[model samples]
Target: MMMPAAPETDAVRLREAMTESLKTSGALDDPAWRAAVAAVPRHRFVPGFYLPAQEPDEHGLTVWEPVTADADYGRWLAAAYSDRTLITQFDEQEPDWAAPRVRHGGTPTSSATLPSLVLRMWADAGIAEGHAVLEIGTGSGYSTALACERLGSAGITSLDADPKRLETAATALHSCGYTPTLAVADGWYGYWPEAHFDRVVAVCSFRAVPPALIAQTRPGGKILLTLSGWMYGYARVLLTVSGDGTAEGTLLPGTVSFMSARSHAAPAFGNPAHWVAGLPEKARPVRHGPERITAATAEAFHLRYLAQCAVPDAQLTTFEDTVVLVDVVSGSAASLTPRGPGWDVREAGPVRLWERIEGVLDAFDASGRPGPGRFRLCVRGDEQFLSHPRLPSLPLPSVGYGRASTTGPSASRRMPGSGR
Candidate 1:
């Protein structure tokens, strides 16, 4: 008897892989998600490019060209549509209009967010049948397809700032025989002309909630978006727009990275090396500190200081030998490096930023027992007020406008709040 034929192509293998992922993730029963995943031809959505496999090195990870072939189209397709994120934009934007090139494993600007995460976020928003949903950030339009499939054509509107991406997505949708109102506009504005949406979903992340978003959403509507700039991980917030024009929601457990909306795109941190060159000459190392704490707690502590310090821009990245922090405010960046047995701060101005962050964590530890239940978020219009169970709201101290907190004497205070 002839044996069963081997898996013939990448697309075939991809289907099997995705099927297996569904089985293991317990997402098979999700009909809307299954239908959306199956209906969208993922191959059509990807560009003709692939990221090189990573090679670990002494300095850091290095990237080399990925072996590409005809079947690679299917591998890319499967990866693009899988239950994980596929980075689509790097450094700043799409590298090439047609094919993206992989450089130093730089920051991702856009991507196809994980399918399961998208589905859960959509479900969490409580999108109902025939509900008018306003989807902000139409990255590849894969999520928009899912939205259209769930809400139907007449009730959904999707917006994106990148006109080229929109055009590509429109074509892909037409090929799949589905169409929704696609607009080329800054999603941060929330397409106010089409207000009163039952659900507002931002596929991208934001530093603060936009006023237009609150105004456009109908009272009692659901607003699901990512509250970004977290030290450890971004929180997926499910908010309910209240009758009083304010919204509040608990943070979901899952964490996912996303492109910041164009209007809220992070400003550049000037000359990364400059910060490295300005190391403080008299800094001492602090002993007795632990190496690996809960990533969540670590991130939260960092975010707390960022908010309280009134720093306009700060970025944190960890390495085997060091944890590097780059702070850019008023177009100048201060680099702080924490290495084995010692700490160094490099900048033209305040040099104790790193110590201030560490101190915040220590103070929180001193509070005895502050945990998840203690963390809180409150935003009204352009102001955000944060308080933990044991801590109270205080004024945000200024530190050379657009900088992170480096001072140690200020009372528990609020920083420049978000404009939401």
Candidate 2:
């Protein structure tokens, strides 16, 4: 009698399926990237992860259910190869890998970033054979595996702030036969021992490009990262390091959000009432009529980016039809609501939050509401400035205009006065 043919392992079949899906979705266009995806077993890296349940629990928190291969191989394998982010840690706590279920109330501290996004960033980094890459935030080592496949193991160095994450990534990478340099250190300070990387890619978002990254990158090296701000506005940025240590680049035409680096994470904000109470005694109303601009609108996305660039630490909260702006450090607060023909504006705080916003909105309007791609970033040492070729570079403090070109017509125009 002929024996039945042996069944293929679920991990192998799933990985192949995932590779095909990625190619079909146009996410794995590069043959090498596709091969990398196929070669590495993602299931091994993420043994257990939390998935949001359809219904939340009694505490008004989303119920995160744990999934493991032992209990249910099908679901686990499906999730492993699926193009979705898997939360590996919550509130800096790693969930029990063997637990059948668990609930997490804290924010996601670490995760395996979506595969498509990882490939996109990798493609943008322009990693070629023999290129030495320094990867920041080696969360799951999935990206590291891909880089290793493209560039040999000797050409990759991955760093993470969390020691636990580093340990986990090292094991996963080794299991996949990749022995990239893994270090437990702050990503803000690029691994100095191994300097002069051909490319630097940050998996986490940053308010500003770390000077160390620029210093460690070889001239003409590319740096890919997601630049985010207090408003939660994010844009993918690709910068080319210059010989003088200054890097300049334009914002790519897309939106990407990632967890902030642990070291650079924003401080927790106190009660909003405290900020509102600290406002100046005098109250004011805005002159402009009710505008359609808002944080949710597509066109306003770039405006939000500009707003965050102007006030790096400002926080925005929206409810119903009103938008509340608060700066914890400066103790400034402003509430703008639609009333009658114009917005009812309330201002309190030393920072003149409403007036600052008004000036930014006016500037945005004057510029015909340009897209985020029009914005350019110039990094000189620790200071980074965002400007438009058509508009004067607005240094951080002015909150209005930047240095104007003498020869050519100035994109810098006088900001409209704030209505008191």
Candidate 3:
């Protein structure tokens, strides 16, 4: 009779299968990355993670259930090696796999990103041999292990905001025989001791590429991350740092997103009625449909991205065919509703919120409507902005914007990849 394959042997086989799947999916093309994926056992990092259960909670939000290795070894290993993103922590709560209770509803605060996407970012960031890398948001340490496998532990420095996560990631890395440098600090502030890395890559999302990251990178080094906004739009950005403390690059083609840095996420905006009550009674008709600007359609996705560059802190809300954008801190608000052929809008507050959004969409149209490929990013000293050759350079929103608060319904958004 044939002997049963050992658990570790099974892991090797599953890891190899995942590598092949990524190859076929076009998420990975480099032979070095393929080898890294084949060698590391991802199950070591996420022995237990959460998956969205089919059932919705009483509030109609997604309910999450844990998939622990102890509960179901076969299923757990399979999911760990699968291409899907595995959520490891929720609402900043450290998950207790032993208990394995069903979570009614909570935001995903940490996750092991989709396997294929992790490898893709490795390739996209152009981290080659002998290059020292500073990896931001060491959530699972899976990516760090992959880097250590090819680049070696001595040159890879991984950082995360939570001390608990860094401790957990350090343990996982040690199990994988990696002793890469691990630091605990907010990714926005960046790790300072190990400055001037060859590459700086963030798995987390940001409103703008933090100046600290640019300051930490070597003169010729590259910085890769996704720029996100309260509007729920995301775009891939890669830039080369300069000697004068600046970086410039264009948006990479294809869709991309990531969980916002906790400090960078949108603040709760209280009640809609309160803001709506402040708007003017009369409304003005506009040329374009509100759907074109606010809908989740593929056509409008990039349009929202443009609007985000114009006004990063502008939060979106929609109800009963009416769409509104609010600059809560600046006391700006606008509401739009469908009219005969176009839409009618009412504006209020200091900033002309709707007018700015409408102007951006119009400018984009006048420039032959270049796709996301035409988008450019430039970071200069304290200011960061997006610029197009034909259009004006739009400055990113300033940080520390305040919000009004009152009990209210949750705003609707179309953020993909539940979170990290």
lDDT leader: 3
Q: Give lDDT tens digits, candidate 3, residues 4-123.
A: 346577788888888888889887678888888888889889977998988898888888888876677787788888999999998898977778788887888899999778887888
Q: List the residue pairs that clash in candidate 1.
A: 231-299, 232-299, 278-346, 311-403, 311-404, 381-420, 394-414, 395-414, 396-414
Which has the better lDDT: candidate 1, or candidate 3?
Answer: 3
Task: State, as a TM-score between 0 and 1, how close model 3 is to the true structure.
Answer: 0.90
TM-score top scorer: 3
lDDT of 3 at 159: 77
Off by over 4 Å in 3: 1-6, 293-299, 340-342, 400-420
Count of backbone collisions in candidate 3: 0
lDDT of 2 by residue, 1-420 (tens): 221233136678888998999999999999989988988888778877888989877866898888777666677778989999999898887666766557746789999888998999899889999788989888988888888877778888888887777778778877778888877767766776667789999999887777777888899999998877666767678999999989988888765789988755667776665555554555456865324334366666656666676666678776457677787777677877776666777776667666766677777778877787788888886467888755556543221122222123222111122000
**lDDT of model 1 at residue 281?**
57
In TM-score terms, candidate 1 sits at: 0.76
Please give each candidate's TM-score.
Answer: 0.76, 0.86, 0.90
Query: How many residue pairs clash in all the candidates, one count each?
Result: 9, 3, 0
